[model samples]
Target: MQTGNLLPLVLALAVLAYGLAYMRSRAVAAPLGGIRHLKSLPFYYAARASLWCGLPALIVLALWVAFEGKVIQGLVVSSLPSDLMPESEGQASLILSQISNVAAGKLDPQFVPPEIAQAGSLLENLRNQSQTFKAVLVLLVAVLGAAFAWSRVAPNINARESVETTLRRIFFVCAAVAVLTTVGIVFSVIFETIRFFGMVSFWDFVFGTSWSPQTALRADQVGADGSFGMIPLFTGTLLISAIALLVAVPVGLLSAIYLSEYASKRIRATVKPALELLAGVPTVVYGFFAALTVAPFIRDLAEAIGLEASSQSALAAGLVMGIMIIPFVSSLSDDVINAVPQNLRDGSLAMGATQSETMKNVIFPAALPGIMGGILLAASRAIGETMIVVMAAGLAANLTANPLESVTTVTVQIVTLLVGDQEFDSAKTLAAFALGMMLFVVTLLLNVLALKIVRKYREQYD
Candidate 1:
């Protein structure tokens, strides 16, 4: 009876109707008819009938769910006594909730006046009416769809081909939706970054040496000039990512080699998921570990070695990030290496090459394309990592290669720029978008290059 509950009831009825239609279609025609009677089978007819009966009703239910709250609120606001209505938006929402509760008989009558009571009754009636209308509409659509499907169903209808074509279209639409969503996100980042560039010169942001971002809030305030140099941030990002890759690539790649080429199946089944546990660990936890454990350890080691090291060193953050990326590289690379044909390894072995030799010379070369793909993917992840850098790497944007010094990364800068208070139109907030766009472009390029390399190598192996 309630509008909130109508969608589920309608879906249930639609499913029930589909089941009945399917049964009727099947009863009328056996799955395999005499050689002259059918093109495909009876189940295909049932499936077609069921899909037609249920899909349209489900679509309508989805639309009603998406917009019903807005429609109900508009109706309620138009019917309300202006004097009794709450002034603030927050208060209005609370009032609406109270009114809904009253209509549902969940609220006491003493809290509401006679006029409010009449309004509650009207709301209840409206809700019931709306639900009835939706259910009837859905039922009518389902019946119409079923009737159309039934009319099309005959001894000679190519139901299998029709179902396959429909399914293919659905899958293609899903793929398009996914691709469009990614493109939309990239465009949004680009547009906002362009707005930011309009406020700050592209050359200054990219090439300037200084990195301060604090600025005065008002136009009349003095000393509001903010520096927006990105060179230092980008340098820091590269340094950290390089260090992480250095740490992760060797360990990850070797582990992948062992798993793919040498480890027993029993060992692999146990070790693979255990290694994936590294990926599952929260970045925030890694952040604290880097800040508390790794940073201090690096600082102490630097002091012992007669070198000055900042407590919050870029090395510490990068090291932890590397550990974090290991599973990503190892898991992906292992799978790629395993996918290489066994014949390549066997051919080398048959020529009196040792197992290690075959793995190193034959399997490794054959799998290089996929391995590069994994490393590129891992590099992109390292570039995008945020939490560990924010917590461990100091905010100062230093353009030095010395890993012991405090430094910042693009992701860290973005977090610092947007964290607390921000005006959407300010250069400071907009800079985050620019940084994001740069990051996106870099990752996209890496992926494209990796794919190209993989494809070329794959052709050679084939």
Candidate 2:
């Protein structure tokens, strides 16, 4: 059976096991007077039975799914005649793809080699047998596990402790999976980045100002001495992000302050939702707005003031991105300001301080950590924005600090580098991983700074 179909079957069996176990527990208790005499409630016994029925079966299914393809492919390859066997990994992959296409009816059998047709037939037969065995074995295991757990349930059994222990271990495993997934991603990016650096000098990539990354097909080819310098991309990213922050922070912060501190309850209820609606708008819609509306407006305004500007400029993208992240800042800051202890505000006011003084001295400081967190989040959003920039700011990678010029960001370059059918070993493709590694490092540093600020402010308040 397919994994999706098997999952529902397993869950149905678990539910059946739970119901049976609950009835059994009640019957055993009724003979011994009542469930009060039992060590744990009937719910625990049913839960334990459900866990036994589901957990082992799910684990086996997972392991089978994980290794199924490799094991099947190995068997099929081994069965192939020596003369027809692949000599390299790439050849093997091509053979597998052909076989898969034939098996799936995507390729005509008469067009393929006789060996490939035979292999496709073998693959289909083996897959059928594998699914049949998998379904039978999983169901058998589920039944056996449920029976064992049902036999163990009695008046004196501590089913609560057993269930709790199992749940605790499951939670720990989930946390471990999350951590290990992160570690795996980091290592994979690092490995690709190392390969990228082997092709391009680290200094040239980091410090050089040129940004062209098209590699030459031949050494004699003209206009393809690819420069992989990342400075221009970073410069554009920071310029746009700075513009976004300059636009977002004051407006968002002031809106938050007014909403939390001065607005009536009804007004807060109505206005906050309307304000936060900006966050729900699709980024692609924002991109369209940036391209069709904001860019033209900025260009017209700059021309009116006798300033030079590109039709697609960073300012247009940054302004729209700032508008997009406004809710992220205002909502978080407003919540943090509201969470400040009311006594501090009252104490400042009691000392003959005005409303603004109390707000500045008592409330803002108390909420500074959270407010900084909001700003950091908005900054990250702005830095990571792609659609808005791609739409409003042309992908020129201009190393200029001017917001009125066309430029591209690291993220835009990364997307450009990996957009099509590209070989992974090429510097052009691997550069994406290097860029990702740098972006990850930059975000990590921001997170660390945010943490330090939160800790410092938390210590002061505590």
Candidate 3:
């Protein structure tokens, strides 16, 4: 049976187990004058039965599904003749792909060697057997667990403890999965970054001014040697992010203040959602807007002002990105400003302070740490943005602080480096990981600083 089809069956069986256990628990309690005489309620007994019925079966199904493909593939590879065996991991992967395509009838039998065709046959047969065995095993386990729970559903059994313990374990497992995933990602990037620094000098990547990463694939090609300087990328990133922050911070902060403190309820209700709708706008649409609308306008404006600007400049992307990021800043700041206790405002007003003075001296000061945290988070968002940068800023790694000049960010270069078929061993490909590491470090520092600022100035109130 397919795993998808088997899930509903397991759920139905769990429901049936619950019903049966509930009845048995009631029967045990009825003779004792009510559920009051039982060790736990009938609901707990039923819940325990349902949990045992479903959880073990789901765990089995999960394990089987995770390893089924690899196990079957290994068996099929082993069945191949020794001479037909793959030499390397890549060869093995290619061989498995061919076998899978043939098994699924996506490839013709006559196009491949007899060994692969036979392996395809074995793969299909093993998949069928594996699916049948998995269903039988899962069903058997579910029945056994349900039976055990039913037999234990007596007046003396404290099924509540068992159910709560199981749920606690499940929660712990979920938390562990999230933490392990983050660890895995960091380690993967770290290993690749280490490999990258082996091929390219760390000082060259960090300090060199040239930013070309186009190493020739063959020795005869010109520019086989490439510059790996990252200063240009970082400069463009900062220039664009600075422009974005310059536009976003004042505008968003003021809007948040107006909505939270000054605006009427009706206007605040209407305008807040409208402003936040910008956050929901797809980044690709923002990219198109940056490319088609903003970039051209900036170029023409720069030309009219007797200033040189690229057709795609940092200013265009930064402006559009700032517009995109406004909601992030405004929403967070609005909530934080609103969270300042109403008493603070009343107390300031009672002290003969004007509204603006009250806001500046009391509310804004109270919310300053949260406001700063939100701004830094928005800055991180602007720095990590890729689509707008790619669309409006041309991919010339010119080390310039000029917003009107064409420039690319670290993210754009990372995308360019890993866009298509890439050999990981090459410095060009590995450079993406190195850039990612640097980006991570910068964002981490920003977040840490935000945390420090928040903790240092945080005020607690009843």
Maximum-TM-score candidate = 2
lDDT, candidate 1, 324-400, per-residue tens: 99998999899888888888878888899999998888888888887897898789889989899988988889989
lDDT digits (tens) for residues 244-264 of candidate 2 = 898889999999999999999
Off by over 4 Å in 1: 1-18, 30-36, 65-136, 143-152
lDDT of each: 0.84, 0.93, 0.93
Pairwise TM-score winner, candidates 1 and 2 = 2
Clashing pairs in 1: none
RMSD vs true structure, all candidates: 4.3, 1.6, 2.0
Per-model TM against the reference: 0.83, 0.96, 0.94
How well does candidate 1 match the true structure, expressed as C-alpha RMSD?
Answer: 4.3
Off by over 4 Å in 3: 459-462
What candidate 2 gets wrong by more than 4 Å, as runs, is: 349-352
